[model samples]
Target chain A: MARHAQKWRDAPALNSGDEVNKASQSMEARVINPRSALLSNYEVLSLLQELEADHLARTKIAHRIKKEEEAAGTDVSVPIGGGRPSTAVETLENLRTVSFEAIKYLSADHQSTTSQTPEAVTELVKSLESYGFTKAEKLQIVNLAPQEQIELYVIVEELEDRLSQEQMVEVAEHVKKSLAAAPSLSIVAQPSHKPLIVKADENWDATDDVDEEFDDQGEGAGVEGDLDMEED
Target chain B: MFNLAILKDTVAVHPADFGTPQELAIMTELNKKYANRVLHDVGLCICVFDLTEAGEGKVRYGDGFLWYKVVFRMLVFRPFQTEVLLAKVMSSDHNGVRLSLDFFDDIYVPIHYLPVPNAFDPNERAHFWHASGDAEAKQTELLDTPVTERMWIDKGEIVRVRVEGDEFYDDEPGPVKMAEGVQVVKEVQTRAPFTIFASMAEQGLGPVSWWATAQPEDGEEQDEIMEDG
Candidate 1:
């Protein structure tokens, strides 16, 4: 009779153990399989939010870089061929400035027999153009002296004998004087163009008055002419 | 075909052991062309040698003395030709020089390149050309003459050779091959280190120095020594 009572107690314990096992298996199954659509939606939403936040951060970084560049006034756009623009006004200015500097150093003292003042040279250029001289001949005349300019004019007019005898003699004398002057100026202005015009100002006379004082002070020592030219 | 080194009929070699007659001839010609030549400008001749050997003691990667040799066969011979022009002496001294060329170029020969004349005659045109700047020249013509030349030059003197195989002293050498219709002129002016330095100190551009008539202390010392003697 006691044994039968013990068996009854054991049977209830066994039944409880089976029930616990069943509950555990149900929990495992729920975890392994997605039973509800709500959890999936929550996970997907979380992932999308993370990606959006990363994208926003990257965009903010790019915007900040752009803003900083704008503030500094830097043109960061790459050219088609990765070359600096050739049409820059600064480059043209630099070239003109250099040319002007070269012209400035040219001096009358440095002039050779072939050298002429800037004004004389310009006049010769105009004359040569009017006479329809060859480009090379015109260029050569422009680089010549006042005397040479006269000679070239006569020679071009003569066309190797077209000019009158008087013109020929006059031109020849001018050429001789120019040739004689060549040695003096050539020695001083070696490798330099002659009759260098440093400054071109219509109001140069006003400043030239002051320049005489400057010359007396030896400030304009190597200048072409002093105040005496003004007295003339 | 020629033997690279002629033997005195002293040795006998099997036909298989000796190099071919053509090979020997090639070696002989190469040796004759390159034997005494020195490595001039490695930087300018980079196309001939490996780029890695520049500035290093090694001339070429393959053989000895290969880098020192200039292949003269590849060069063209343009004869010495120039038009001589008469020019008047403006002003010249040991320090600076200015002369006109065809009234076109007023070439300024500064102190360093002023060709000093050892001896000259005032009446002689060549002598005048040589000694115009020298104070010793009592008289000089006052005129401009033009000169032209196509040839090798050394120390401002025209050399007899039509083609210069090596321009070792030039700061910049001419083109390797002067193509037809293309003429690129190269000029090099050498100045004393002190002069260059002084010019730089005074102005950005190289201008002639201001003339000072008084002699320096060194000149005074020489004068005193002369007096004592």
Candidate 2:
């Protein structure tokens, strides 16, 4: 109970501070450097999860306190100032909403974040060091976990010129291994978009050889797809 | 997708908050001011990362609040140009497709940025790509295929897109005026402060299901052999 009281008291003096800053024109906030560092999706996801857990705990404690006050016959419904909630309460609510939305977005099925861990991600980075990929390219590779050479081509520019076919295959294998080693957590319900099943003989022409190569590396993903089909 | 931005702000701490630690009080004040808000060009601010420096507090003549100049780092949601990202389709129209990251929903993939030979189906209210039987020729030409064969980018489907650009609008509130005898309330136009432009024209960048691994003929043959055995 004492801890819960401290949480509300921790709300800053935003109302008065804003008023002061508005009155003094010279005190306007400014950006020093817009891009000081880059943060990966995993970093942001873990941080938000921590913040959300804390917010939920505090909310539950606050609700219990309100119920107790009501049982004691104290009127707890009165607003602190006339009929308006305090700015502190409003700020906390804003934080809760923003964090919740961000978490949902990051945990979407398209993102491979749920199966990623700090150790696996770090190891993947170390293994990718030899490829000499740009920072942005490396980040995207880690974020997407592309299983096929074509998918890697999308993230890494000029794939044909930069790396040979064998090297590309090796990179995809590394990503697959890392992802497999990590424990998977289903954060969001997977969208029930049925797999587009293409008959093997329907389009078996010169393109079949190329697709066979893609299928070879993505065998792990193919097995998973088969499992989903079986369940259905 | 997230960048750390360093910003400087003058924080005013009231006497009522003096009981708390100095840094905690200042951090609370900063978060209240910046969290979940969009800066003009920096992108959407998420939350404060850490404080770098805080100058000595100064007291004003009239107000009892102490003001301090603080420099801090904050997390900002700003994807780089040409960066590939995954987003869910929010809606579709003649204009194009609107995407959402859930928190930030002002993403638009213009019609031209979509794959070529695409047509908007008013009846279904979604766009369909006229894919050809030949995988190589699908992007260049439209084949006269049946409706069931075409690829439809329906609502709620996840798609991979490349970030093309971003726009920021500085919309300041206009001054209020009294007209004639009645006080006319001016209708304010609400626009997103920041919007991202994305594209899905490239290969390996479309619906996730489209790129799902194709089962090899050899694997299927192996299954048939096992059944016979």
Candidate 3:
């Protein structure tokens, strides 16, 4: 982490204080600024995959060069970020099976995911917004599939008087109905929409209840987007 | 950020699967063989995007399986260094707060990496940062500022972090961390395959709530209520 801090401190943007500077080399830091949005699981895993991918690419070239140098009986070194390359056609392979396992670790059920087809969950949340369901509330409705108001209430307990039990049930029912009516809607809703293509994680672990437990960065521009709704 | 990476691999077709069309069999085998694997150098190889090249299968050796050489692209995760990212607090202990991005949950921002003058409250099982960075000259200017003064980052707080460095030395555990020749380190080998060492001690790089002026969402209220309860 100190190496990482040194790498960061080298950046011209950070030249504030000695404490911060020292801590930069000390350990990974934590913050509580509300402006920081909570990253969903998919977003995070995608990043890790990216980071790992980068590492692999660099390392492969480094190792390949090192191998050639070794064959030439010359001392060689693989640079800091990389070392190790393989067959000519054998590029670094991050087997989808490997990443998907990580996603499955988060949640195995394919049906209960946030969206049946990527955009559906976001669309459902957007459509429900007119009906007064917050994004978090709607996500809960889709993820949990609460059969009754009490189950839905378990998620939206913070609504206070904003939504009555009847409204809660109504919203939950509406989400389910939309999903049922639009199992293929995601395909049609945003025909050109391509989800995080390499996104491995399905959704916040059903047990995670991302909104309930984690401080999700509620970036409004997340998955949910406005779309032309097709009715029954 | 997610990006398309070109990946190539050879997948084998079993006798049962050989009944399908060559392309379909190769696609299924490729999907089965390549999905969800992470190559330390390339990145996490996601599902096969599309095949760029596919070779005729051969009944190689005595394996009785047909091997097809296939070239394809898969989605990959590869964030550049210093890229700002968001992570969710997973657990807090004396070591530090463990962060997760759901699928990739091995991020750790050590106590030292936290804002200076922060302390871990064992009772609360959270870390608190005493606000003191802005000078008085800066503070007085904020007398009427609409920002909610933040105190600490408790468990479950969402925070933006800078990708400082990645730590994954694919070496067997040394005696120090070895339990009878097996690595005893739980977080590294099992908790997460990769640990993203991130830093939030920088400006505009901590919890978004403190920096953003948006009114608190239900998550905030839920935490407050839970804390009180």
Give lDDT tens digits, candidate 1, residues B56-175. Answer: 122222233222111111110111111111222344443443443221123334443332322222223222233223434332322122121100011222111111121334344545
Put down candidate 3 lDDT per residue, B143-189, tens digits, no spaces: 33322343557666667666677755455544556678886755544
What level of docking quality does candidate 1 show?
Answer: incorrect
Top lDDT prediction, candidate number: 2
Off by over 4 Å in 3: A1-232, B133-150, B172-192, B214-229
**Local error of candidate 3 at residue B83 (angstroms):** 1.9
**Model 3 per-residue lDDT tens digits across residues A89-198:** 12224443345344443233322442343445566556667657654445445554444443444445355477766666667676676556544322222322223321
Ranking of all predicted structures according to TM-score, beginning with the best and ending with the worst: 2, 3, 1
Docking class of 2: acceptable
Worst 10 residues of 1 chain A by lDDT: A29-38
Pick the TM-score winner. 2
In candidate 2, the residue pairs with backbone N, CA or C atoms under 3 Å apart (3 or more residues apart, or in different chains) clash, namely none
Evaluate every candidate with DockQ and list the scores.
0.01, 0.28, 0.06
lDDT of 2: 0.71
